[model samples]
Target: MSTSEPVPDPSAVAAHSAPDAPRAHAGSAATPALRVRTLRLEDEIDLPAHLPRDLTAAWLRHGQGMVGIGTAWTCTTSGPDRFEDASARFRELAAAARIDDEVGTRGSGLIAFGSFSYSASSPRPSTLLVPRAILGVLDNDPFLTLVDVLDEQEDAPDAAGAAPTDWRDLFPSTPRAERTRVQIDPDHTPDEYQELVRRALGMIEEGRAQKIVLSESSTVHLEQAQPVATLLSRLAESYPTTWVYHLSDVIGATPEMLADTEHGRLFSRVLAGSRPVAEGSELAEQDRRAFRSDAKELAEHAFAIDSVTSRLADLTTEITASAEPFVLRLPGLEHLASDVAGELREGVTSLDVAGRLHPSAAVSGTPREAADAAIAELEVRDRGGYASPVGWMDAEGDGQWAIALRMAHLETPTRVRVQSGGGLVAGSDPVLEHAEALAKSRPVLRAIGRPED
Candidate 1:
């Protein structure tokens, strides 16, 4: 998909009228009306397995036009000491952009962007991008009309006449295995962990917040430095369903929401109690079936669904939630999942639901505020962009927000930083907890050219 020239700004063009604006119809329903139009892609395509190359090609061809791309993968961890707070500063930049004001008050239909993740310790981060401006840009471009065109080349024969292997090789080389090493938090005494959890629980009792996410860090000392891109690609390959993404200083590698509209076209999948659903050839039938039947794991997911559904109900009208958890299989792993839908009530917006449901039990823990504080004290490193909400929403309240996981931020190509951790509860074991963290980092390590073993 390519375009010839720079796409004109939608704002400069005749305003198409914001999605939230009331239409002036002579004979509409008497009740206060809400109108929503779906932005369905005329075509959908899966890019050739050679993602980076294809991405580069697409960029060269259509970089002039406003384009939207979604990259999903598992990423590598750059070790615990590599984490930073660049996301806090990114938030400041967004605030400076006045994105909230631009989209909320001014009704400019501005873009919304951010990151989401599962912990401060994920090796793999997922990301998604939906540029609202692309709608206007592609309005006149024939090459960009279908989503399928992007997928069209997936099965096409390679020019060299060799059968395509797994698509993972499309990217550059990842870091060597020798560089992967685990580190322990110097300050993480057992007493300290207990204290942190106690204080977090107290905060919940005090009503500062319901649940808070807490993290404990284990540092991994690398034998040598690795490239950030290599780690990102590994993560993408490992977890195809997860929205693997990397910003210069931010990462969003989890599956949350992407481009959800009132009219009910949601680009992303919500993982709750059942396994994530798999599409595409990357996942095998046996793997899919096993993922679908994992009940013990599903129980773990129910808390997440209950939390999200309850929060949505408090904020919206006409809410509907899935009764059973479904499978959501990404490239590297699978998740139990569900869906919640509802009409936005009066005086409510997407961000409203987001705020209410953030630090979800899936990422944080039950009794939110307490879990968060526990994570802060127990986890040696600050989360920065890890487990935060990241994505874009437009002025029309049509946008996506995904949990950032399976991701890393490039502090420098040779010195990228990443983090990954898991949810802990009363039954949690410290050793198993540590292993889970390591498993999560596999994606990032693979992205950066590190071996899983």
Candidate 2:
């Protein structure tokens, strides 16, 4: 049951935020050694699962791409000016790409898998990378992309170009333990998070800002470091409908769609307004109706929709949005979800759309700048790629960018920092929001083999 649907776009969502642009490669900028050529592989393969040795895995439904960064010419960038920096580098790299599209499709050529930090101020984990070798599975068939690092005199595809045949081993097997003990750091106690929430709500009351998204970061100590594949596979299995991604050390299943663009058609799904179906809460119709009618939830959802539509309106034409938000049910929660679709203007790259619509009210808040300032002043710790855009873009500018949410950064093998945040609006209760943050962490927490309490 492999569906090769085009990828779609997310929310805990700000792991690290950045306006992504720079890309650093192995060679000096003057003598760019990048020579990328993609071949349509005749063989079918499972992506992420059978990724080449040490390759990064990314998937959105059936369409996926894996890249072996090891020995692969790679480009990385970080800093306050990373977005513009990475963008310039990507343009240069894409210019160097030479594609032999035997079976022309979205993922058949040079592509980059990226994870931007949630903010420019926190630059530690921000990355925009181009893999030396890309294995993309599109429409059940895979395409093998080979990148060459050539000297001034050399010009030809690498020896492996004869056939698209590859059977590279997938490393990082799943962990065997049923569960590992997890120690949630005390610095991010619920009380601390609640206080932040209270402060934001107070600001809303005082006309400081209509809304602000407040978040907390919790570090979990795992008994051991599980292979990233283990958590990615778990996320894919447990949240089959969501986009599962792993780049560098940032990994998780994101439920919201930031935006996806294909052949000029664009799709953006914004999810906000959460209702937790606690450990044993009934999913009764009466409860459903009450939640749908809840004023606070509706307000939150409206802000997200407005934020998306307002931004998309500038970059697209014939935009249309669902009049009402439908209930998006995940494992332990439900969210008010609205979809906006439009026809993109000419020359608009998917990343361009992502940059314009990011930090939407769904993840950022009603007034984006105000929420950002609040987050910077309060959350203090680096988000490490939590809520930024995490997805892939290609040479042709077709791609899917999902908001980094429901994620954690693997600071080290033994430590993964889980991130969660909620929209703070007037009349919001801090206690429930605290619970919501905990609920958001459940995905990453569960991924690390945390035992059920």
Predictions in order: lDDT: 0.41, 0.69
Off by over 4 Å in 2: 1-28, 31-33, 41-44, 51-53, 60-73, 78-81, 156-165, 169-179, 279-282, 451-453
Residues 106-208, candidate 1: write the lDDT tens digits.
1122332434344444543322222212221222321221111011226332122212222233322233233444332323555665565566556656666
TM-score of each: 0.53, 0.86
Error of 2 at 10 (Å): 25
Every model: Cα RMSD to truth? 15.2, 6.7
Candidate 1 residues lying further than 4 Å off, grouped into runs, are 1-110, 116-238, 262-299, 346-348, 451-453
In model 2, the worst 10-residue window by lDDT is 1-10
True-structure lDDT of candidate 2: 0.69
